[model samples]
Structures are given as C-alpha cells and as structure tokens.
Target: MTKSENTLIRLEAALERILAGEPKRIPKNRKLSIRAVEEEANLGNGSCHYYSEFSSKVRILKSKQRSSSSQQEADTGFTDFLKSKAANEKRIKEKYRSENVELKKTIQQLAAEHHLFNELIRRLKTQSKQLEVENKELNVALENTRDELTQLKRERIFKLNKK
Candidate 1:
C-alpha cells in the first residue's frame, strides 16, 4: 500500500488502541511520509515542503519544455546558417571561376606580348650588327678619300713649285 494509506492505517490503529483504554502518546517527532500533495495540517513557515517540491517539479517540467523549444529555434537557425554558408561558398566559387578565366586570358596576352618583345629584341640585335658592319665600311671609305685628297695636294704643290 502507498505511504498515505499506511499513515491512515497507523492513525487508525493509534486511535483504536486509545479507545481500548491504551492511551499511549503518539511520537511528536514522527515525520509523516508525504507524496506530491499539499498537507495543510503541516503548513508551517508559510510553505509546505510537499507543495514546494511539487511546484519545483512543475517548474522543472516547464523549463525543460522551454529549453526544448529554444533548442528547436537554434536548430532552425543552424540550418539557415548552413544554407547561407552554402550560398556564399557557391558565389565565391563562381567568382573564382570567372577570375580564373580572366587570369587565363591575361596569361595568354602576356605570353603574346613576351613573344613580341623577344622578336623585337632579336630584330634590334640584327640591326645593331648590320649598323656595326656599315660603320666599319664607312670608316674604310673615309680613309681612302683622305689618302686621295692628300695625294692630289702633293701633286698640286709639286706643280706649283715647278712653276
């Protein structure tokens, strides 16, 4: 039987024994075993232990429900955060793809420009060699012309001295 039922039996037995001329004193220090119920007879200090214990149980249940609801909201938020992160990652990947295409084009253009610069350098070196050869030829021609002019001046001086 439950504790309350047992208490009821104990009280009844105590009362029966008193009626049988056995007036034994009930122990004042006997703490009554209570379940989840308000024992108003034991209502002291403006609160019942059983009532407070019941209220605390109720508060705990309510708090659990509140926590469960809040956790559901957090789960929704986490899903949204994951979705946003996926969208952002997709956007970044698209950006990188486009940038990679542009970079490839730039690399191709730079390679072409590099080839043109190498060709220009080769042509410049070829032209420089041709100029050097032409310079040497011009120097030899100038020496020949100076020698002929000197010979002509020498003949003129000899003829003039003869006159």
Candidate 2:
C-alpha cells in the first residue's frame, strides 16, 4: 500500500486499541497520538488545509466518545499538551540549524584544502620539467669537452714526431 494509507491504518488500529476497554469512553485528549502519526508519515508541518480539517474531525470524534462530565478536563489537557509540544518543536528546529551551520563550515574547509593540493601538484610538475632541461644541457657540455680533449692530444703527438 501507499505510505499515507499505511500511516492511516496504523493510526486507526492504535485508536481502536486505546478506546477498546475504557470505562468512560475514549479520552478526548488524543491529539498527541494523532500528531505523532502525522510526524511518522512525514506530514506534520507541511500538510495542506485538508489535513487540518481531517485532524479536527478525528478530534471531534474522540471528544464525542468521551463522557459529557469529563469534557472540560479533556479540553484543558489538550491545550496544555499542545503548549509543551510547541516548545519541544522549537528546540528541535534550533538544534537542526546549529548542525547545518557546522556542516557548511566543514565543507568549506575541505574545498579549500582540495584547491591547495591541486596547486601543489601543478608546481611540482613545472619544476620537474625545468630539472629535465638542465640535465640535458649538462650532458651536451660534457660531450663538447671530450671532443676538445681528443683534438689537443692529436696536435701534441704531431709536435713530438716532428722534433
């Protein structure tokens, strides 16, 4: 089944069980379980107007099932619970914001380190090319010196034979 259907099924089953053997009917203060289900379905905050209406209907159904004498108590309990839940939600949001800021800082640091590493690699490659050119020049100079030494030896031999 689809995700929403699955959540609705679970909500219905839990509601049935909570109300099953109650002496004075199900308590009207069931908003917590209802909201918990919404959160589980990933629709707690961003639901459309229809979701609000649906929740109201379920709440009314719960209220009607309760004893008339207990209505005032149930209403008070629901309001108090809502206040505490609102505070809890605020704290959660703040925590998430702090974590997000830390993550962004870490990502920025990693990017900078990667850029530095790339620059180091480029400089090493350039230096290697320069060293190769210098080595080739030295080899050429050594060969020229060898040729000049050979020519001088031949000239000295000719002078000694003429004497």
Candidate 3:
C-alpha cells in the first residue's frame, strides 16, 4: 500500500481502538491530546501535526471533550463558592455570639453600679434627716436658756428697789 493509504489505515484503526475502550490505546485520564492520538495510531511523534486531516479530527474530538468538561468545571466552581459562603457565615455567627456575651456582662456591671448608687443616696438621705432632728433640739434648748436668764435679771432688779 502507498504511504498515505497506510497512514489512513493506521488512523482509522486508532479511532476504532479509542471508541472500543482499548487499554493504553486511549489516554486513561480522559484527555484526548494530540500526543495520545499519535501514539495510538503508532505514528511518529510529529506525524499528526503534519497531516491536516489528522489535526482537524483531533480538534473535533478535543472540542467535544471540552464541551462536557466545561460543565463539570462550572459545577465545581459553584460548589466551592457555596462552601466558602457557609464558612463565612459560621465565622460571622461566632463573632456575634462573642459580642453578645460581652454586652451581657457589661449590662450586669452597669446594673451593679446602679444599685450601689441607689444605696449611697438612701444612706445620705437618712443622715440628712438625723441632722434636721439635732438642729431642732438645739434650737429648743437655746430658747429655754434665754427665758431663765430674763427671770433672774427681773428678780435682782426688784430686790435692789426694795433695799
């Protein structure tokens, strides 16, 4: 057979092997690179690059794989985004929980301060009332002393007039 005919036969056989799941005839990783095709066809390393028909066929196969691969990549990206979002939400929730705990503690402290201030005011009011009572008693004693002094002075003046 002519060299071109031989190449065509090898290329057809390679395509059949790829479709038939022949081990090592196709890449195990599901990537149909040009190298894999050339190896399957038992062609020289650069043979497929030289043949326009072979190159076009490789392009067609790769495009087909890419269409399906693109969908899978999109799904993976969405899944990663969801995972990140969930983690961020959890972090925010924990932060808020800690802040809430601190706020509750602060409120308790303020309540204690308020109670102490109220107690102090009550004690001051009681002291003020006691002072008022003492002032009233002192005023009464002073009035009694003044009356006694005036009586003594009148008695002395009457005795002197009699003498």
Instruction: Give per-residue CA lDDT, model 3, range 8-124, as digits (tens).
Output: 778767766775668355565556767777788888787777678877987898888798789899899999999999999999999999999999999999999999999999999
How far is 103's C-alpha from truth in model 1 (Å)?
1.6
Score each candidate by Cα lDDT.
Answer: 0.65, 0.67, 0.82
- Say what the RMSD of model 1 is: 14.8
Reference-based TM-score of each model: 0.62, 0.41, 0.62
Q: What are the candidates' C-alpha RMSDs?
A: 14.8, 20.5, 4.9
Error of 3 at 30 (Å): 7.7
Q: Provide backbone clash counts, one per model.
A: 0, 0, 0
lDDT digits (tens) for residues 1-163 of candidate 2: 9876665665555445554532123344444345543444345444422456557765776567555537777888998899999999999999999999999999999999999999999999899899989889988988988888888998999999999
Ranking by lDDT: 3, 2, 1
Error of 1 at 49 (Å): 11
Name the lDDT of candidate 2. 0.67
Give the better candidate number (1 or 2) by lDDT: 2
Those runs of model 3 whose alpha carbons end farther than 4 Å from true positions after fitting are 1-6, 16-27, 49-51, 132-163
Which window of 10 residues has the lowest lDDT sum in candidate 3? Answer: 23-32
